[model samples]
Target chain A: MAALGFGLAYAGFLGLCLAMDRHHAELLRGRPAAGRRWLLRGVGWLLLGLSLLPCLALWGVGIGIVAWLGLLTVAAYSLVHLIPYAPRLALWLGPLLPLAGLALSLAPT
Target chain B: MKQGFRQCMAWLHTWSGLLVGWILFAVFLTGTASYFRGEISDWMRPELHAPAAGGEPAILAIETLKRLAPDSPTWFVFPPGERNSELRVVWRNPPGKPTPPGSRGFGNMVLDPATGEPVTARESYGGEFFYRFHFQLHMPPLWGRWVVGFCAMMMLVAIISGVITHRRIFADFFTFRPGKGAGRSWLDAHNALAVLALPYHLMITYTGLITLMLMYMPWGVQAVYKGDRGGFQAEVFGVAPPVRRANQPAPLAPVGPLLEEAMRRWGGPPGRIEVQQPGDASAIIRLTRRDSEQISSNPQTLTFDGVRGTLLGASGEPGAAAATRGVAYGLHLGRFASPLVRALFVLSGLAGTAMVATGLVLWAAKQRHRHARAGRAGFGLRLVEALNLGTIAGLPTAMLGYFWANRLLPLHLADRADWEVYCFFLLWGLAALQALFWPGLRSWATQFAAAALLGLLLPVLNLLTTHRHLGVSLPAGDWAMAGTDLLVAAFGLLLGLLSWRLFRRAGRAPVTRPVRGAGLARAEGA
Candidate 1:
């Protein structure tokens, strides 16, 4: 559940980063159009909101909110460090992490 | 006026941060390590390798305490739980009896719950030293706490002023240019570290002050209780009044069923059991709910009549003010957090430490340029540089030295715990002396290299001196032992890289970039 939350946060931050001019230029090698930027921003906030579900499910409302905030920080820190050095790997991990988390959750203990 | 306001905030941020940066670094680093305090202590006591036994720990602990200190007025029994592997019991000496040597009027022992026998581990403070030093700083209790509290206040001021002073916090949120020139690189690193964990930094600093609020601001308590501190404590913390002994001797009822009942009520095992006047007709037993089971440091205790094994009372839910205080205290301690959340706390702590380190170095780097242009280093800049070197690199060396002393010191040595602490300060003092003599990049490199050596060699020393090395522990699934070794080695690798970088930088040409009013530029940039 924590991994799923972390993955969604990472992916959400990635979307927000791509919406910015500087990061988008560095990672995508082109400037994002106005419509594309707005679309990215909307999706980013949506994904971040969606990420709260796993945390709320894992812990109750009180602690889950705190855990979600911490997970967001971790995800953002990872993205900030990786975007500079390993942008492709940073992007790849977003999808891969959630898939891995899903497989682990479904597996028999 | 706007510009003047920001400049004033910039000055406040710089001075506030620099004044207490070194102590803040130490506090942050040690506090981070304390998240794994139980694991570190377990690793230090290698003789107690077996997992907690299936039998009732409270029963075993009570049986041992019955034999060990039968006449004592009070007994504190901490039964083996998730964090600890042995049942620990402490008993206060009865009146008119000579206190046990080295025990300070109390007798304590670590008992293997499986057999109810004492485990003969070497005397060491282990992770308790870091946990204590985190807030108290190893000084006399009142003095250390006051100094740390002052620094925490300064840190809070710095954080708020820093946010106000920063011109482009969001724009530079994800920016980090390590390969840039010294001033720019350090500033970027500091900003990134501080910003990344900004929420954690704020929460930790605020809660740290709240933890020791009574000491810092006693007026409220004094005004309310009129010097009756005990009354305030009893009311706020739900501490039951002390019971007088009946003098008539009586066999205490079995504790197993009582423990089971308490556990059933709390939905978790009790963290501590307090037996007052044990074996006496007026005996009282209080069981405290484990910290891990709730997000409040305020304990929920159930009191039982020890002789009859009947429930006396349970502490009711705390009032609004007390509950708020309890949650704040709980958030600061992070005891209720899961392993994953605890890891996040540790990471945020490290980020805070690094933020302080970079901020200090940034000040030195900015000042050195001005001093170079003036053709001589001033006394103040030199002093700050030396102190920064001694604390940043020296403290880790001392911590590792303490761990080494735990392994190398003989088991039967008198006051072995004190000796371990002395070894820590001895190493730290040596580093400070060396830095005082040579406060330069070379000195920084040397100290970091030494720390790297000590950290890397610890696991090897453990293997030579004890059976609980990585080789044995990893295969046996003893993560407490194996994790400590691996974590130290990882830190060793990091310090090694840092030392190599400084050494390489020192070997190169003196990179004296042109100073365009470096101090003003920094004030403006910050």
Candidate 2:
């Protein structure tokens, strides 16, 4: 049950993070293309909803999501590092990796 | 003071963080492991490896107390429960040393829960040592605690100053560029980790200070109560009860029933047993922690009259002052939380450790790149590099040595655990010496390998020295032993990998370009 909650939360978290990373990248690299703006914004806000309650609860399930999120982010990070042309992974997964890492640590193993 | 807030904070953050970084790192690492301190103690001592049943803890406490402190002035028995297996009973029998008996008191561990016999659980002062050392370190007991209290205060200041120093706080959110010229990466890591759980950092630091605030500002009680520590304690928080002198000697009242009552009241097992006198005229018994709301699980003591063991009214909690203090301490310590929250704390702790490591490395990298650009890494740069290597690797090497001493030292030997701990410092001292002599890549690699090798082989070392092994331990559900072995293996693997990587990284030519990209350069002036 904790794992499920953690997963749902992390899934949304990851999606949101992806959009944020893109937004960050666009700023750093100068400007973002016009049409793609909504994708990340919509996803990021949606992820917040998934995480909103569980984070407040700060229970096993919440930590589980956070942990799974960390693992996923690590995976996404590895993908970014290992696979060229997957800059998109960084765009999406970068923020979540660290945030999830922090959240996962909210409970003891 | 003369400078702007940003400049002053920058100075404060750097000095404070650097000065305390080494010790703080050690504290964080040990504290993280302390979650499994009991398990470590269990693994360190193979004979008493079973998870003793909790149903009989109260019984064990009663028995231990009856035997150990039949006529002590006071008794402090740590009741056995889910958290720890050992049955420890402490008392103050004073004449020579008038002060708090502190560490020196009659102490024994109930070896086996099944047999109700004293099993030889190799005199390991391993787990609690770190817990004590975490705050007080190895200095003079009370003074050490005060020192730790002060550092915690400074840490709070540093954290605040760091936040102020970093102007682009929100702008540079989620920034880290790996393999950057070390300085930039260090700053990024420092910012990232510090900011990631900024609230946690601040809370921990603040509460840590608050926990020992009494010692730091002893003048508050001292001035008000005119040096009456006890009176101040009773007045301020009402946790520590007042001492009563008994004129007439009476048989010590039975504690088993009181504990039972407290347990009935509190709902959970009575976590601890506090008796004013072992077998005296004035012996007040306070039984606490049976059942309480999750909001505040303070050791709700059910005090008893000294002579009759008659239940006294439930009292204390100086109008929410003590309760406030407790909640702050509990939340910071994670003692009140469910197991899951503790797990999160541990994860964050590990990440925090990583954060420090990354930051330290970044500092070195920045210095190196700067030196390289200047075409000469000077004497000072060289010295800083050596000091970093020495402290970072030396501390762990010392820890490994401590474990080895625990197993190798004879049980009959006096002050065995003390020696074991001393060996850690001794080894750490040697590491510093070695760093000075070598002053290069070779020393780092060698010491790291040495630490890792020892850590990885810790289980094997235990097996060879004692009858404990994986086969016997695993099936028996001796998670302590199994966990210790697994942790050792993990450390070994990590160290081994690090050693290899260090070797690989050493071979690569230094890069002149700052490693900033991927949002790491947000705040830095280009």
Q: Could you say which candidate leads in lDDT?
A: 1
- Model 1, runs deviating above 4 Å: A106-108, B52-54, B100-104, B511-526
The DockQ of predicted model 1 stands at 0.63
Q: Give the per-residue lDDT of model 2 (tens digit) for B378-462.
A: 6755666566667777877887777788888888788676787878889989998877766555566678898998888887887
Question: Top model by DockQ, which number?
Answer: 1
Itemize residue pairs with steric clashes in candidate 1: none
- Candidate 2 off by > 4 Å: A8-16, A21-39, A42-46, A49-52, A55-109, B1-5, B49-55, B94-111, B115-117, B236-257, B278-282, B290-297, B305-310, B315-318, B510-526
The count of residue-pair clashes in candidate 2 stands at 26
